[model samples]
Target: MNKVLFFAHLRDAVGEESLEVEAGGKTVAELKAELAGKYDLPRLETVMTAINEEFAANDEVIQDGDVIAFIPPVSGG
Candidate 1:
C-alpha cells in the first residue's frame, strides 16, 4: 500500500490528511486518477506531488509503502 498525504485545501476536499491506497507499480498519474475518481476532486491534477519526500513527476512509478504527498498551491497576502 502507498500512503497518500494531503495538504491545504486538498485535505479539506478529501476530508482527511492522509490515506492508504493500493499503488504498487502504478505511476503517479495513475494514482492521481484513482484518487480523483474516488474523491471527486477534479483539480487533483494541478497539485504538486512528492514521493518519499522528494519531488516526483507525473510518470514516476510508485512503490508499496511509499509516502506520496499532494500539496496544492498556496497564496496569501
Candidate 2:
C-alpha cells in the first residue's frame, strides 16, 4: 500500500488528510485520476505532486510504501 496525502482544498475534497491505496506500479497521473473519480475531487491538472517528499512528474511510478502528496495552488493577498 502507498500513503496518499492531501493538502489545502484537496484535503477537504478527500475528507481526510491522508489515506492508503494500492498504488504501486501506477503512474502519478493514473493515481490522481483514480482518486479524483473515487472522491469526486476537483480537477487535479494544476495540482503539484510529490513522492516521498520530493516533487514528482505525472509519469513517475508509485511504489509500495511510498508517500504521495497532492498540494493545490495557494492564493492570498
Top-TM-score candidate index: 2
lDDT of 2 by residue, 1-77 (tens): 99899988888888999998999999999999999899999979889899999999999999989999997876868
Model 2 stretches astray by more than 4 angstroms: 75-77
- TM, every model: 0.90, 0.92
Error of 2 at 16 (Å): 0.4
Q: How far off is residue 46 in model 1, in Å?
A: 1.8
User: Scored by CA lDDT, what does every candidate get?
Assistant: 0.88, 0.92
Q: Which ranges in model 1 have alpha carbons more than 4 Å from their true place?
A: none
lDDT of 2 at 13: 82
Instruction: Report, for all candidates in order, the number of backbone clashes.
Output: 0, 0
**Cα lDDT tens digits for candidate 1, 1-77:** 88899988888889998998889899999988888988987587678899999899999999889999987775768
Q: Which candidate is the best by lDDT?
A: 2
